[model samples]
Target chain A: MDIDNISELIPQPVPLRDIDDSPGPCCMSFGFDLNPLIQSIEKVGLINPPLLKRDNQGSITIIIGYRRIKALKSLKADGAGCRILSGDDILPVECLLLNLYDNLAVRKLNDVEKGMVLARLIPWIKTLEIVEHYMPFLGLPSNRATLSSYLKIEEEMEVRVRESIACGQLSLRNAIMLLDIDSISRSSIIDLISNLKLTVNQQRQLIEYTVDLSHIQGRPIPDFLDDQSIKEINSDTRMNNPQKGRALIRYLRMKRYPSVSKAERKFKKMISRLNLGKTVKIDHSPSFESPYYRLEVLFKDGQSLREKLENFMREDIDSLRDPWKKKK
Target chain B: MDEGVQKYKSTKSILLQLKDIPVRAEKDDGPEEVACVSNELKRDMGKDTMHLVSYQGEFLKPCPGTKEYICCGYQILNVGTNCPLDCSYCILQTYFNRPNLRVHVNLEEQLGQVFQTIDSDPDKIFRVGTGEFTDSLALDPIIRWSETILRGFSERKNTVLELKTKTANTAGLLGSKYRDRIIVSWSLNSPFISCREEHGAVSLTRRLECARECQSEGFTIGFHFDPIIQHSNWMDEYRKTVDLMDKYIEPEGIIWMSLGSFRFMPALKPIIRRRHPETSILDGEFVLGLDGKMRYFKPIRMELYAFLNELLHQWHPDLGLYLCMESNEVWQESMGWRPETSEGLGNYLDERVRNFFG
Candidate 1:
């Protein structure tokens, strides 16, 4: 079981077409644009040959470096110098495991790709063993819950969601929630979140708001996400991605908690109804996660402070409490 | 009575292995069940198998409540860990990983211990319920938990046993003579929610019909409007359910009616989404509450509770109305008064117990 025994000192030049593109079910592909990879290969030649195994029909399926082959193919290279298996001898699990080792030592794998790897290994190895032994090398939390969660995403997720996952746009936590929704809803949700390119935390919040909104409305989530308002933000050509992201999330937040949003809106309208001078300021929590509030007034001197205090006192603070806090 | 309880499709058989089982010793299906009992058995077959092992944990624990919210100081009798009747918003979906109806086979054997704890605290009214983690009667035909629990709580003056169920599995209770302190409660929702979200559960009318039959047989009845999901025309649907309750149930015969807005752990949102793709229960307006669980926004919770409170009060002013896991401000606004503390809520319920069963 020497690890070094699996790999050899030299590689063979195998024809590009002969290296069968279909890498079977277990191959985890990054699907990156290969121009950059081709540039690197052209500049430095092949770092290491693509890993491969010879099948019964003398056809070769890639064991690793699918992208490397693609890069080489784009260059019209006739043959890839491959670290070919000695014979048609390696198990599929061994090939995947070796590839997993290659990814770990060379290019770091994202959670989604790790999920793909885990999905393949899950059918062959015991889950407890995978949870204990394999997850650590992939940098995943080594527990049955985490392992099961990743496999669920790989096996059951919609193709659109899987695409985001493949592109490293969605976190495993956010992707897991998407699975609970209908297929059409799942992709639309992933698409919205992906378009916004929200951070992992914001992505989670956005997902929470969307899922809850979907449940509360009893409408398919895609219907809510596809609202004319959100669609405008999604297709808004003027705003940047950040603006669109904020706008989409803001729309979802308002829809998700209509009462809180209404209360805050009324509170702001009443503050404006106060007819306070522009110098005075009113602020509320960005969202209703906290009920904490802030009030600010610009003052130049004691006389100005006194005048601002008088104006604030004259304003009906009780008006704010009267109805929003009051149960209808 | 079995007709009220939705019969489980016998797709899977009970995998039982208990040291105390000699009654059905001929089958010899015990060893394989023991092997499966260890949760290391993964989802190899894509189907869950029910394991009725004699659980080896404390069966009774205080209901996990957040301090930010006013708790009702209820005790949960852990008779089992999962349910068969699939509600879309059920937390049990993600709460346990190794899935199945894992009934603690020894709950019947452990009843005396739970009752002993309750009996030990005579001054303290422990409102004990077995339906927190699992439906108290969903498996009554196979588990027969009602007879054992009713037999134990028959004369326990300090404690009231609440067997909360969505099913009409009262054949066990019907056969048993002990009914003094047993509360056969049903979890109700708006007609829309009942039909749409609470899958595999008997209809609200059927549940009310079951309540009526149980009340007629001298058992005190309870009703829980737990997980009241918000939707369009929710008021009318809920009112229809209330009207049905008035039709089938005698208000005076009921000892308690609990109203709780829908709440769930944030982790459960995805689980529900995946488990029930067609579910709209998650579409409700929710906020990450003082507890990490997602709850309806305060005003929304207040509105739903206040509406149900008014409707239920109109049906009967003395339904012993209470809110479950809400802040004090919510209590005052929704129910129009605050229990103030868990002990205060406990005392309020204890007063109801004294009035009903003293």
Candidate 2:
């Protein structure tokens, strides 16, 4: 059906209570804010009447303008003008396409909304069709992996996690990581993420460390996160949220990689004993994967360089070895 | 002997064998079906199915080795892709886009061309193996790959065909009269890893027993400790496997034994986690190497390789111990000597081949 001809339909008054305001089959909106839409309807009366389909039993379902109807309902309007289509006149897929195209023309759908659209399209069209045409049309990467991630978002994620993703508080990549755990663990992790206000990178590190530690320690994620040290870090008054996040990640990393952490601590202790001055420093490769260590010296002139080198060479220069190596 | 003969006759040809197996033959239409399906569905559907297609790619190619590490210049014999054994740490999980136990049905017809390539370079010892892409003997019971290609390789002088496997399906090898220039190798790991991670594989004791049987039948065997994982009491656990080797057979008949720590591409982490959630293989402290693969920390890898090298050398001094794809520092520190470069490692293995077979 040509959706352009729908404008020719006459408007009728439908009682707000009679229409099902819940998200219908064609609705792709989720974790959306109604304030802007509500303000718009308050400033100017409903500019375009919401499209609704009435069944033979007189039950009404909103096809478009779900947000508009929701705003009107909040405004306590008893009835509003709506463009009604007989349920038999239009197909469900056609209604979905109409809403999709209408929404695409006016605004961009958030990640959760895109997931909702894909979830709805999955029942109507083939996955190949959605991947080739609808995914790109919805501004998502046209790949099965990306499609699978979005489907999980819509189908498996809890509402609070979806809200976190939609509001840009949590990243979609991090949210996908939470899907591997149970709902309770996911909720607790989401709570920690929100409370700490972690950056995307920190969120990823937290989830990775938590998951790896859980697997290694043979404990669930909630049980792992409920350790006394973690709780102490979270409740520490001296540290801010970002500090708490970093401290929690450090704690988990130490637990996950005990040998690496111990080696790092040993190196730190040895370096402190050497008393390398402000201008002189020593460093090792990340994780000590490289067999060599670096000695850096900063000087103002050639004479200063020589003096600093001579000074650095005097006190236990031969003691520097692989941190994991025992003294012979 | 009659039942063995009948079983061989039933699966002698690919077309004849298809009658016995439960398979759905789909028409070749397009790439849409394979490309668009979810990985979970693809894995479930492809696990038990076999697709017989005439492979059009090069039948013989060099192992794709990175320059950052010393690779033992082995060549890959493209007999098939994918494996029946679903080890949790298998790199084949994310390596292939299409799924199935794809056996190159035209391998018999293409043997002459592969031999021609090796014959063209007579001076270059082609250390070819069929276990790189798929297990060399996992499907040998039905596909009869051994019956078709064993005689050709047995006749060649400059090459050795290594049929590597984790299975005890050596009936085909023993059934064939040809034994020269064929190395029957088994991928050995700790019994804990074998039982927990390697799904559908035989037990460690069974594998060692098969190795002993092959040795008694005048077949020189090999063992690989590639992907030695770090778990609880890993040192003691791995010792159990080496001790089992001591009980089964003499180390004097063994050829090369390789030691390699677990490494994988970054993309495979999620796949492993999803496919095998209870796996302890990913619990090590991993760092990105120059080759862009995540490997155990340098110290951890050295520890593992060093322990195994000492243990295996103690079993037999001439077991031809080597590290597969390790740097010069790692070689010197772990194995107590350095191959220094890929060519150097290749020459070392070639020398071992000459000493054993010549």
Candidate 3:
């Protein structure tokens, strides 16, 4: 086929010929929509009309744009004149390829359709089949496994992605990440995503919250959690071996060395020195990058912040007023 | 009838006097009788306007295992409760302590606080909807709360308003200047469920007609099939609902639609058990969700989602459709897709609204 003079090569419609609608191997999938093509037709006046081919028996058949043909039927019903130019009016190979390329590019399959496509495409159908079926293998050849992974991503997401999509909170990226998370943590993943209004990194942190793997970007998970006690432990550990990144999940869970009093001393020292917010953020330190404790305080203004600090000092003084007897 | 029952029944104020009104039909009743009771109840109750007690602002803490707050999404204006239309599975029966159909009569102050919050974040888009804890438009005829919200939000670009209800009260909404900013959302159910589960509610066609009118008036419409119950012919019923929606409302005009399967707390089970003993909602197979709410099992949910999703995609291909609060695997299995990233969904939706209206 001549790449530029492709229009002359494509077979045009033989107006009086009968077309078969049987499920042929060459038949396009019905799951796709034709409205975009119809829209294109109404917009640019069918810039490249659908390519038609004549069977050995002299009947004209559509190699593609089954949806477009159907839409034209509907448009014709609404008094829009429909016509199929002669076989000589076939679209250029380059334009035809571009049209199909744009059509598939523009088309977005729903979750189920995506799943169905994935279930059929990546797992079963071979790459040669796609190449042979569509015949435009010029740019970014997509293999079955690659498409399958895309499908697998969809297959794996949290229920909230669907629910959020239904409720309008989730996006395609959000859905894929939700799928990457474990099923048990899916709801939590969605909740964290929507409620916290978390960033992508934070969302990933929440998804990794349950998983033991908390380290990301060479930073300890405790650093991500912003726990003060964990940071103190990290600093102590760093002095001994500068590059050794500690896993906070292990420290919090294992309770190695440092007795309860020692840990409490460390905690109090950190809390007193640092500004602990009204509500303390206590993370399980499930990974090296997470926190043992984080604090966030809300103050309307600088004055409010001063007042809150004063109120805290007054409470501290009030606690000091109570005399306690030393007992053994 | 006994004197007490008669006193509570005949005296419109007494019947309407519940702090948390429980409305489950003892038997199927006529719409006229319901209308008559609601009319008398409104008259005896006298005033029907928003009486916002207070803008209860509290730090909504997160729940266990989930970083998200199990929020009512938007703030609760607490306008009224116990809809005149008796929906069989009305959440109000157990959700509210008092359902005496109370409307917070103080609109100006409530609007003032709302404006304060909205003005607080000029750069941030604050979505404040009225139907979070109650039906926003059930008392629309008398209260006209949506009009007030529409009028208030018309000038504030930072805030988007949603008036969600099961009622087809669009008369108050028509010709509003804030039609673009205010999304007129409706809770839709299958005709079968509407007839059996919902009483005194307008017919499905009527609701769709109202939606069509709103859409034509340049208002973006939203449909919600929340508490999508499991029934033998639910697939056909939902398919019909989607079909009617496609026929009536313009596809591009739909801002969003939500699908939530029937879920209930353990506390609500007894209410349904006592009130709607014959309701088939509880009869279906169920399992406790991670949230501890009773929900239909995985397979049932998958079936429901698959059927409804296919119908919706076929009908309104571009319409924004999402499932409410479901897990990732279920989202993947039923819808065959998931969010690529969790952070962008809200922004994506906000952008959709901006593109449509802004």
Task: Report DockQ per prediction, comma-separated.
Answer: 0.31, 0.43, 0.01
Better of 1 and 2 by TM-score: 2
Q: Chain A TM-score for each candidate, in the given order?
A: 0.78, 0.92, 0.37
Better of 1 and 3 by DockQ: 1
Native contact fraction of candidate 1?
0.36
Alpha carbon lDDT of each predicted model: 0.76, 0.87, 0.54
**Taking the tens digit of each residue's C-alpha lDDT, what string does model 2 give over A1-328?**
3567899988999999999988889998887889998898899989999999998999999999999999999999998999999888898888999899989999999999999999899889888899999999999888888888899889899899999999999999999888878899888888889999988998998888888888888998899889999899999999999899899888888887888888999999889899779999999888876777899999999999999998998979788888888886
Clashing residue pairs in candidate 1 are A180-B273, A180-B274, A214-B283, A215-B282, A215-B283, A215-B284, A216-B282, A216-B283, A216-B284
Q: B19-113, model 1: which lDDT tens digit per residue? A: 24332212222223211333343212112445545566888889998787878888898988778787887777664444556667666557778
lDDT of 1 by residue, A131-229 (tens): 778888788876666776787777787667776777778877778766656788777767777667887877887777776766666667778777888
What DockQ does model 1 achieve? 0.31
Q: How many residue pairs clash in each candidate?
A: 9, 0, 63
CA shift of B298, model 3, Å:
1.9
Model 1 chain A weakest 10-residue run by lDDT: A284-293
User: For candidate 2, lDDT tens digit of each residue in B1-358?
Assistant: 1112222232247646567676554554433343466667445537676776567799899999998888999999998888999999898887545577877777777888999998998998888899999999999987888789899888888988899999999999999998988999999999889899999889999999999999999998999998899988999999999999999978988889998899999888887887887789999998788788999888899999999989888888889889988889899989889988899999999998888888
Task: Sort all candidates by TM-score, best to worst.
Answer: 2, 1, 3
Off by over 4 Å in 3: A1-328, B1-77, B340-342
TM-score winner among the candidates?
A: 2
